[model samples]
Target: MPDENFYLDNDDIRFNLTHMVDLESIAELKEDVGSPDCAYESADEVVETYLDLLEDPIGVLAAQRIAPRAADVDKEGCHYDNGTVTLPEPARLNVQDLAEADLMGMTLPTRYGGLNFPATLYTAATEMISRGDASLMNLFGLQGIAETINLFASDELKDKYLPGFCTGEHSGAMVLTEPDAGSDLTAVQTRAAYEEDHDHFHLTGTKRFITNGCGEVLLVLARSEDPEKYGGGRGLSLFLVEKDETVTVRRIEEKLGIHGSPTCEIYFNNSEGYLIGQRGRGLTRYVNWLMNAARLGVAAQAVGISEAAFAEARAYAQQREQFGQPLDRFPAVQEMLVRMRIDIEASRALMYATAETVDMEMLLSEKLERLDRKDPRYADLRARRDRFAKAAEVLTPLAKYYTSEKSISVTTDAVQVHGGNGYMKEYAVERLYRDARITSIYEGTSQIQIDRAIPRVMAGAFEALLDEYADRDYGTVALNGLREALAEARRSLQAAVAYVNDQKLADDQRDTDYRNLTARMVCDMALDTYLSYVFLEQARHSERKAAVAAKFIQDMAPRVEMNRQYVMSGDRSVLQQFDLLTGAQS
Candidate 1:
């Protein structure tokens, strides 16, 4: 029998999917687009059938196959031999199972043989897959490479590559990072020289820390222009290169975690390439789009890992005995378990909300592309598209930042719950802890996400969201205290935002120095309030959700106040004593 406690049995996920999100509208959109394979009469039927078809098989596979092999996969890891990268037996089998199930290219168009599900459904699947094996997500999440191709590649290129991706005959990698160009793409030095006679570009450079770099398809960012003449990002272009004799996996990194995923240092020695989209717009346009999707994928991974960690902690707390009672009977252990569970739910709430916004943005954008400007509804469609786009811009980074940080914290507590056992490889929490460490570092660091999210908060992008939450009745007397706490958190967020805005207007130097610190405080304040409201909303349907909401708000309110006070304090000691702190010569 399959484990009954797999992802499909997650009450939080089920509630969010069935009750929290607007599945009816999404179903309507999917049906209107034409359900090529399945027929359904109503929106409810469409949603129910879609969820059943996607989630059931995934849950069984995760429980019966992936979870059981995850530890061994991590142990065996990936191997490099004679320029060929090999996945461990378990990892290889995992991929084969998913491929045979036709689970890849989920969000691509049906014409490309994809399921064409919305981003919300796809994100949910990603979360489940990550829960099963965080390492495997590194491979499964590369579907973004196919989505990028579908979005930007010419028809000929799409025809050549996308079908194979849908059929699971090809996997892809986003080859962006170089030795010196980790975060700053402007420093990318890989060269792509166009050959007029051959009608193809030849790529020559080294890319470092590329996940799945050994995959069949690679989207590489290379400097197509002379660096001496056009320096920085302007010289960069996006190119699609397939595995060939010219491309070599020189070495793979021995990482701290997710060992099953190969991080390759690849050498491109005059590899054949096809340009994607326009020249010089790789970083400014295509890569930015790809990064957003990747960041969201990372957020989902974080949430899934957190859920897994929490489950391990909770189960252990219930089973482990101390002084003739379960460890869960002890107050300290109980506190840790409760906090872990709350954090997992809160992270999921934030992720699903962001995913819903992403779905709105994507579907609306696609609709606008086919819309005629002269049509009566074009203006409305355009307006909605832009609105959702802005919301996604703010929420995606916010989700990524909050969930990644929460995953680290939750996993730490999970380890703490296991005591010495968690430190040993005998338990899964040790591996989970290591896997959680990389979430905030990759797909844009937590610091980078804060910088991206701050402007959105200051510009009033989330003001309407606060108002909407404030107006909801929540339909319960017990949730009133939680509502008040949420309101207080929002006020604290606004105060922090006000302080940062004032500093920006007061002194340019001070603003530049303290912007990151200020943004961090405000972003935390916003997340606490947003998640509290989500929990309060969820409370209407489940008493368990109400308990979680109450605990979260009670714990979060004081932190929000502390951040608010720190932001308003105008303490510039870090800036004032920078040289002293660093022992620099003046």
Candidate 2:
């Protein structure tokens, strides 16, 4: 069994918690000073105590307890007998350990038996959990389900569900995807009907590929409009349904990776459900809110998997010899190790930056809601909230798109670093590589993320944010040089966006197609420029980080220009020749 505490041993995570993130400020906002729900003397105390908890009981549990059992959990997998899904013994034990630590409701209000930590801290803990066992993080990370109910569900529902979720007595699933309605949720065929006599709604639909679908509480999306007046997504409503005699687990998928987390096909035959929030806003409001947070959680999972893969590969490289010298001494192997670590750090920086913005948004939202209409602070706070919301919108998809893609590269390199051994199941990288494959596909694919992010990139959303980062003083000549390189890349990106916009606006019939074709290059340049700023900001904290920033800026500046050049080409051959290239029937 590994005895090293995952949180304490990781210098990068330690750096983030101590310096990169303002946990103290977030704690001050999240915790009530007058009468604290958690045991704390002050905001500093809250920060201190929380970090301690993560190191000892929580991080220790993850590294010492969960990491040891992950192999067995993956091997035994989940068993579906008769209609119920049961976790393997190791997986069950992992859940039990987390529940014992009162970790199931990391983001809920303390009033509801939760710690009420900000999303920043909650996501940090999630990274550690995923590092321990990526499969287990699926079950553990669904705490966001309870948070969604708290946000949109009725008070009656919150009273009944929040306590159970916080106490680990109950677990839940978002329950959105269907066999026919995977990416396009508007195609959801599930039906929900109100039974006024019983004062409830009945949900009848099938949900496929649901993570932890066997959970006790399910927040389902169903079409609720009148047949004659259906309005696409507007016709959909969110429902809080429970697992009962009416709900059945039809089958569990077996294959690729994360086997400990069951991918379920579930059937709801008139299952009793209560309407959550107002009617006709399920996909537009509730599910959108749930999915944005879920995408962030997936990014955390990707970075955790990257961390694990790097550790495995680095350990092997140090010990294994190539021809007469240790593998790490070789330029080829050393380059792989260096790039893998830099990628992990860059992803972590982006993920935490996005999470911090979300945390601020949540805090300001609560304040804006409670303040009187005439209060002077209301307008200023609301403006800040709106800006944060926009930043969060761009950063969330960018984080998801980049983190998942980088994780795939990092894990693939782990396999390559091990030569043939990494391909064998005997190695941890083999499983980590398999596990990392699904992050890009689920929640939302990378293509889907690009489609969502491009409009914001084109809208010049990064202009103000980049300006704020640019104003910061780096305190060193080398760091200033990196900042200037990033600035040059930003200028190139702005020009590319202008060119694409000008071209698309000029064409009426093919504008949308043209935009779609160039979307990836636009988003790539935007992300490359944005991520360079992130690393430059990190350069202030450590000399080693400054070196990392130098290497990354040097590497990405030319790539950003290259991507911009591609967009400037006005390439329409892909669309014009689609029929010829594919030999399609006209």
Identify the leading candidate in terms of lDDT.
2
Model 1: which residue pairs collide?
none
Q: List lDDT for all candidates, in order.
A: 0.87, 0.88
Candidate 1, superposed: residue stretches over 4 Å from native: 1-5, 31-40, 228-230, 504-510, 582-586
TM-score of each: 0.95, 0.97
What is the alpha-carbon lDDT of model 2 when measured against the actual structure? 0.88
Residue 558's lDDT in candidate 1: 91
lDDT of 2 by residue, 52-141 (tens): 877877789888998888788888989999898999999999999898898988888877998787888778888888888999889989
